[model samples]
Target: MHQSFISYKNFKSLKGSVVLCAAVLGLYVVAEPSATSAGGTWLGYVGGCLGGVLMVWLACLGIRKRKYKNTELLAVGWVSTHIYLGTALLLVVSLHSGFHLGLNIHSLAYAFTVMVILTGFYGLYAYSIYPDKITLNRDGMSRDSMFAEITEIDEKSLALSEKISPEMFAKISENVEETKIKTSLLTRLFSDRSLKEGAIYKAIDFVREQHSGSELIKELDSLLQEKESLVGKIERDIRYHFRLGWWLYLHVPLTVGALLSLLIHVYVVLFYW
Candidate 1:
């Protein structure tokens, strides 16, 4: 199985960012502020510039992903750095705001900036987890191959059921049908296998044990069980996709909000201050 991204390498970025934040904090502590102790001061303005630069760099991660792959560009290393630096940007931006907010465009801009960072942290978490799970569960086979196996198993099971007694055929037919069909969204989202796979397995097991002497029943039971396993993993991979991809749905909009807030902040500050 492939490993998760929660290794020492990813955390190394956190260590570096922590050190940088600590040094910045030390400087901020020593630098005496004006009477207001706001972003109008020297350190506060420096923090503002640093935060703005980090925000732009964080956005460039998208470009990094698109432009650099399959080369010696260290894409994985870049992503880890992106996450950690984005984390540190939170502290920097908060320092820039100087624990002071007014009921104006400045506060609104700060709110959206925080929103962008929060969503990014969530995306970071998803990246660290979902990919490994999906990779391990998929084994070596593609989803299409797994599905083709299921389809072939279903056809064989149906044809075999016809040779049995009518009463047995009717009961086994339901099991085959339930095991072969495509899963529902509710099933994919949550563990709804109990009602579907569980019910069919229960009935099939009872029938298989009652007529244990038949070779076809034994083979059919084993085949159906295999199909059940394959389908379960396919659904699990689908869930992992949902978990990973859903973060972008929130992150993209928040990024746009942050950029708009930035533009407004720039125009207002330039015009007034």
Candidate 2:
């Protein structure tokens, strides 16, 4: 019963995009240019205009999404339209170029368009997959709650380790001090933090070395295991969080670059060419 942005209004944007692409394809097929089918021709001009409009509209989606009041369009509808029309814009641009590519500013604009669209595709995939993954990883507990619980476990483990031995106490303290819940952006996104696991394993080994089957050691072992589980969940949650938004960093900048290059390309074509 839950309708996602992709399925908004019974795939209305998808249908519109398909129709638009089909119509453009028909025109491209029928148009007979004086020479090559390039951006200078009549149909090519149409395609260029459509592609330009679509590019500007797609870029506006970031602004549209940020508006929270008095907007006529639903946010989901805007997103759905953005996804569908953005794809169509690629084909329109390619046809507008008459499949011709060269080491020129026009091609540079097209290249930026390609990069922006590719990043947008990755963003769409991330949005679809990561939200559920983050929810499952958190399991109804906020990240702050998980960290708070880890701190509590560390305190209890420190007390138990102190009663057991000085070496155990020192090891537990070092582990707690070195355990990192936050890391560098690239590290959080690409690498798993395993220091917490090493500390837990070392503590378990130390307890086993003591050769005592005492309840205090048992409780300490349980706490270490619990801490390990929480740290793993937090690391995974951090990865999912970064994965969801990192593409926007590339996508937005490339969009701005593409728009600027497109403006220069249009200016040259209209006034000089």
Can you tell me which runs of candidate 1 are displaced by over 4 Å? 1-16, 69-72, 166-199, 202-206, 209-212
User: Against the true structure, what is every candidate's RMSD?
Assistant: 3.7, 2.2
Off by over 4 Å in 2: 181-196
Worst 10 residues of 1 by lDDT: 1-10
- What are the per-model numbers of colliding residue pairs? 0, 0
* Worst lDDT 10-window in candidate 2: 188-197
- The CA lDDT of each predicted structure is 0.74, 0.88
- Relative to the unseen true structure, what is the Cα RMSD of model 1? 3.7
Encode model 2's per-residue lDDT on 1-273: one tens digit a residue: 667888899999999999999999888888788898888888888999999999999999889888999368888889999999998988899999998889998999999998998898998998999999999989999999999999999999999999988988998898888776666777766675543566667776777677688998889888988998998898888889899989999999999999999999999999978
Q: Residue 102 in candidate 1 has what lDDT?
A: 85
Model 1, 49-108: lDDT tens per residue? Answer: 788788888777777788744466466766777778888888887888888988987778
TM-scores for all predictions: 0.81, 0.93
Best-matching candidate per lDDT = 2
